[model samples]
Target: MQARSVAGEAARNLVTGTTRALWWALAFVVLVGGLAVADARVLVRVWQDADAFRSAGAAVQTLASEREQVVDGTRCQALSGVAGLTGAGALRPGAPVRAASMPSSDLTVWEVTPGVLDLLTTTARPVRTATGTTTGGLWLADDLAAALGASAGDELVIDDGRVRVAGVYTWPDDGRDRVLAYAAVVAVPATGTFERCWAGAWPVDDDAAGLLYSATSPGADDLRLGQLNSTRGSGYDLSGLVDARPTAVAPAAAAAVGLVLGYLAVRTRRLELASALHARVPKPFLTWQHLLEAGCWLAAALSVTAAATGVAALVGSPGPYLGTWATAGMAAGTGAAATLIGTLVGVLTTREKHLFRYFKER
Candidate 1:
C-alpha cells in the first residue's frame, strides 16, 4: 500500500507538472542519452578495429648483433613448456642468401621455422595456386612471388636447397614496413635441426619480456643470447590507433549531466514541496517520490539511447553485441544513479521555512 501511494503521488506530480516533466524528458534525454550512444558506439568501433590488430603472438624480435653459436632447439622446447610462453620458434638471424631464380630476382631467401612464420603472418596467408600440401616448403611474399614468376607448387632453387613455393602471403599491410615485401621465408623441414640465429617466442603475459631475453639469450660458453629487438614492423605502434580518454571521460560526463539536471528539476518544485512538508508529509516519502520521477525520466532516456545504439550496432563494424549493449547499460545506469543522488540531496536539504525566501528571489 505504501509503495502504491508513493508511486501514485509521483505519477500525479508528473501529471500536474507537465511542463517540467516534458522539459526533462525531451531536453535532458537528448543530453544524457546522446552521450551514452556516442560512448557505446565509439567503444565498440575501437574494439573491433583493435581486434583486427591484436594477436597472442609476441612482437619482440630478438636478433644477434654479434656472431653467436646457434641456440639449441631444446631452448625453444623449454620455452614452450614455461608458464608465460604460448609458442616458440626460431629464424635465421644471418643475412638471407641471394639465390638464383626465374627472371633473376633482387629478393633473398630467409629461413624461418613453421612456428615462427605462423606467428608473424597469422592473418595474411594467401591462397595456394597449385595443389600441394606441404609445411616444409617455401612461402613467398606477394610482391616477391610476382617478381619471381612463382606460385605455389613451382620449384625455386635457392642456395639452401630446391624448395617448392608453398604459397604467397602478405605481412600486415600497416603502410610502413616494406621488409616483408622483398623477403621470402623457407620453413625448415620438421625433422631438420634448428640452426637459429633469430628467435620468436609468443608470451601470454606482459612481464614475459625479461623472461624472453633471459631464456633465449643465456650466458654460457658455446651458447649466447641475441639483442632484444621489437618486431613491430609497422604493427607494434598501431595498437594505440584509437583515443582512450573517452573511456574515462564519458562516465564522468554522464554523472555531471545527471546531477545538474536532477537538481534543477527538483528545485523547480521547491515551493510546492515546502507546502507539502508543512502539511506533515514525510521527508522520506518526498525523497522517494523525487527519485521515482527521476528514474522514470532516466528509463525513458535509456530506452531511446538503447534504440539508437542498436541501430548503430547494425551499421557499424561487427563487434561483440553483448559487450556493446553492456557498455550502453552501464553508462545509462551510472547517470541514473547520479541523478537519484541529486534528487535525494535536493529533497533532504530544502527546508519549509526557507521557501518564502527561495520563492521571493524567483
Candidate 2:
C-alpha cells in the first residue's frame, strides 16, 4: 500500500512538457548503454587476444630464451625433436599438436610422439576408428576455418600424416594472429614402445632437446628434476586469459561513483537542498521523492548498460576499457539521483506563492 501511494505521488510529479527532459535522460542512457556494450565487447576480445598474444609471446620467449639457457649446460629436461609424419616434433612450446600437418606454404611441420599431444578436453575422443568410418579427422581453428573457406571433412596435407577434418576450434588470438592450419597429433598408438607416440618428459640427458622442462615455468616448477612434466601446451596463455577479473571490475567502480554523484545532484537540485527544512514540504518527503526518482532512473540505466556490456563482450576487440553495462548502470543511477537532489534543492530554495505574499505583507 505504501509503495503504491509513493508511486502514485511520483506519477503526479511527472511533468507533462518534461518530455524533453525524459527524452534527454533516455538519450543519455542510450548513449551510455551503447558505450558500455562497445566497451564490454572490446574488453572481452582484447582480454582474449591479449591472452593469446601473451601465450604466444610467452611461448616464443620461452623457446627463444630456453635455447640460450639450455645451451649453457643448465640441463633442462629434454624430449625428442624427431619430425614424424604428423610433424609433432616441431610443436611450439604452447600450441596444440595436430593429427597431421596442415597444408601450408608458409608454416612448417615437425613430428612428435603421442606423448607430446596435449588434448584440451579431458576426454580426448579419437577422430577415427581402425575401420575408418569417416569420424571427422581434421582439426582446424574456428577462426581458421572461417578464414580459409574450409569445413569439416576437408582433406589438408602438410608434412607426412594424412588427416581428415575432425573438428573446428577457436583460440583466444585466432582472429588477430592469422594462424590457420591443421595440427596433426596422434594419440598413443595402441602398441608403441612407451604406449604413447609423444614422449612428454623423463629426466633424460640434459644435452638432448625434445620437450624440455625448466624450474621457472608455472607447471614445470612442480616437476622435480627426476619427474617429467606431462602437461602439454594448451594453445593459450592461461595465466593472461584468466586474470581479466581486475579489468572487468574497474568499469563497475567508475559507474558506482557516477551513481553516488547523481544521487547528490538530484537531492540538491539547482538551488539548495540543504534548506529543505525551510521549504513547504517536509524534508522526509523531499528525500523520499529523490530516492524514488533515483531508484527508477538507476534501474533503467543498469538494464541498458548490462545489454551493452554483453554486446561488447562478444564483438569488441581485446584491450583494457570500461565495459558498457557497468558504465550504464552507474551513470543512470548517479544521474537520476543527482537530478533528483538538484531539483529538490531548487524546490527547497523557492517560496510558495502564499508564503511569498505573507513575507511581502510582513
Candidate of highest TM-score:
1
Model 1, 1-362: lDDT tens per residue?
A: 39889999999877788426677867656876777777777767665554444332224334232354344544543454556444455555335555576535445666655555655543444655446543666688787777778888888877666767777876544542344456777666333334443333332234543354443444533443332322423233323433453554666788888887888788887887887888888888888888888888777767776777666555565566776666665666677778778778878888989878877966
Give the clash total for candidate 1: 1
Local error of candidate 2 at residue 339 (angstroms): 7.4
RMSD of 2: 11.4
Each model's number of backbone clashes? Answer: 1, 68
Question: Residue-wise lDDT of candidate 2 within 1-362, one digit each (tens)?
Answer: 25666566555555542112354356546654554454455446645654443333222211223222122111211223332111111122223333233333332222222323332121222333223332335445454556555566676553455556555544443222222233333332222112111222111123322333321233322222211111224234434443443444444544544444454444224233334344645655655655565555556666665665655654544433444344324433444444555444544544444344434453
Residue 215 miss distance in model 1 (angstroms): 6.1
Mark the regions of model 1 whose C-alpha exceeds 4 Å error after superposition.
13-22, 25-58, 65-69, 77-86, 93-107, 122-137, 148-167, 172-180, 189-207, 210-250, 305-331, 358-362
lDDT of 2 at 289: 58
Candidate lDDT values, in order:
0.61, 0.39
